[model samples]
Target: MQHLLGLYRASERDIALILQEAAVLKPALLSSPPQSFSFLNGKTVVLAFFENSTRTRTSFELAVRRLGGSILNFSAATSSLQKGETLLDTIANIEAMQVDAFVIRHGESGAAEIVAKHTRKVVINAGDGMHEHPTQALLDMFTLHETFGRLSGLHILILGDILHSRVARSNIFGLRKMRASVSVCAPPTLLPVGIEHFGVKVFADISQALEQCDAAIVLRLQLEREAAGFIPTLREYNTFFALTDEALSKVSHKIFVLHPGPVNREIELSSVVTDRDDTSGKSESLILRQVTNGVAVRMAVLKVLLYDRA
Candidate 1:
């Protein structure tokens, strides 16, 4: 694959290769002995993020550094995009500098694809509007498989703004490809039209969704949706969709919770689950593990993209 624009086009073998590479690298790179990598040696990767980010950008940077690559963080706010320079023109200018690859995050859907078409370098979509976050889904899948030892036959419920979450969309594409059952729960307004066409059941009630799924991937409310009046209020949204302490207390089975955060505490998830992330293998939250796995998955992705092999 010349570019990882979304999971919708990634072959099942491609996904497995990345996950398997990450499984091997995670322990080796994160261990006490800290086995290092040089897959990115003598290569320069550009972080061209048009939107604000925390985990994705940080983890990608750490992943590149760990692989001995040089970093160039490009901010759209400070770049010529502010002065009416077209997106393609700006990307062309950057491409002319001989960068090896681009990690792009943009508020516009298909932005990465456009950049890829204009540039000769490999493009990894960190995120693209509400379309997809491929690496996030890869890392999320790695976390799920690492914890459960398998993804087949496991029911994973994605709870929250499916209409606006790139992470949720990517996860749906990836999990379904891996033969895992997927479902989504959200307020009527927060759910997109024909989302059921994605081959996942849609539930208006969170409790019903939780009851059927083995793991819940809770998503944060898109603040943009609230401003556009997608829902009645935060309190009302929380009442229907929030994974609160009281909500999970009723489920008898062992179910885990994951979030691609900046979590809205007491909203998407309560403090009880978010605050008690532990290493005892008993904490319901796999939030931090997702963050840690992000780096390894990104490293594996770079290895594959740059070297064309895992």
Candidate 2:
């Protein structure tokens, strides 16, 4: 439970404990003047992000501050990386300054693992290039647990740009570890090779994938990394892959919808379906819940990795 490189590194027991801790911490966070935990009172954590981010970076900063830990924001642009210092050398320089943990998001895959190998401090992978976003998966799992009350026997549909989504990879690992059935729906170009070997049924049609599913997680299309001719057009992709109000109507039973943030207006999910919610106003409009739970889940990870639980 030291460095969270990916969901594949975690056992089912480990996942359960992190989820339990997150559930316990979340209520305290929702308090009127949110209660401070201060578990990492004297520790220093460095947020080393080499990629642009909004939610994940902010959530981790809030998580650390809420727990009374000191954070040094590492900006790749302003740092000595521009001065030709090697990644490991830059990290070594930072480690020499008495940091306790490194929360990193890098454009390079295996960047966190490289840091983990070189540093004594804890390394929590915020994300790595098309590799894994482990905390996002944990928070998504927490959100799903809140909705379904259990992951076992639930058939979850992961819809959209699977080939480029680290979130998809992480979710697949976490969901399957908990005994939930997962199915992926994407355009033939968007679906990764050997994805079926991950124990998920792949579908070329979204409607067919949603038929027996209890919940759906719509993924944002990674247009930035996409090559020319990979997708014919945004209009064509939306016509088939977008989770719309019309699509949800086809499901016989009520089901929840989730999206990891920065959603394209009409690409991955439609506005109507995103706004729709259950009586408790929790199920369908779970994007904010996923964001909120992110802080709690990250808190649990930081506490577990940095503190002694004897």
Candidate 3:
């Protein structure tokens, strides 16, 4: 519980406790009369992001502030890293300031682990390359749990660029650990090697994957993957895999849709699907819920790591 590097490292009990805490905290976030907690009062948290992010970074910052903690935004562009300082060296210098915790997002896999290894302070992995994005997975789980009342035996399909998606890897670990039936749908070229061994069934046909699933999480196409020759073009990829309005109509059961944000308009998901509500009259923009739950989930994580409690 000291560090949330990946969901695979957390037991089912640990996951339950975090979600339970998030459930308690979420009410405060939505209260008409705003409320705040002082759980992290007198604590200082450093937001060290070596990667560009909008949702994750903003949510972590808001999580810390709402819990009454001081934050120091670390900018890699203007930092000593630009002057050839090693990642650890910069972190060591920051650690010298006696920060209570470090929320790190790095493009290199195991970067957060390295920080945790070298420092006595708590380290929460916001993201670390294609290895894991534990908090994102936690929020996604929270979103699902909030909607369906549980995760056990729920069929969830993660659709899109699997090869370069840290989100997919983390969700696969977290969802399966929660006893959800997890599957993935992606183009052959975009599917990573040995992904099926994670106890997830892989599907090339999007329609087949959508059938009978409780929910489908559409992923944003990683443009970098195209340069690497995993995909030929965005239009072609959309033709085969995009979650259009037409695709949702084919699903016989009531199915929900989830997407991690910064969505590609016509690529991973169609513009029509993103804006429309589901057949059940619920908002299809689970992306907004994901962003909202992110703060609560992160607050739960900070409480676990900082106070050793839910």
C-alpha lDDT values of all predictions:
0.89, 0.88, 0.88
Q: Which residue runs of candidate 3 sit more than 4 Å off their true CA positions?
A: 278-283
Clashes found in each candidate (C-alpha, N, C closer than 3 A): 0, 0, 0
Candidate 2, residues 214-258, lDDT tens digits: the string is: 888999986653456668888888888888867766656666888
Off by over 4 Å in 2: 224-227, 280-283
Q: Model 1 segments beyond 4 Å from truth?
A: 278-283
TM-score winner between 1 and 2, please give it: 2
Candidate 3 on 115-152: residue-level lDDT in tens? 99999889999889988998998999999999999999
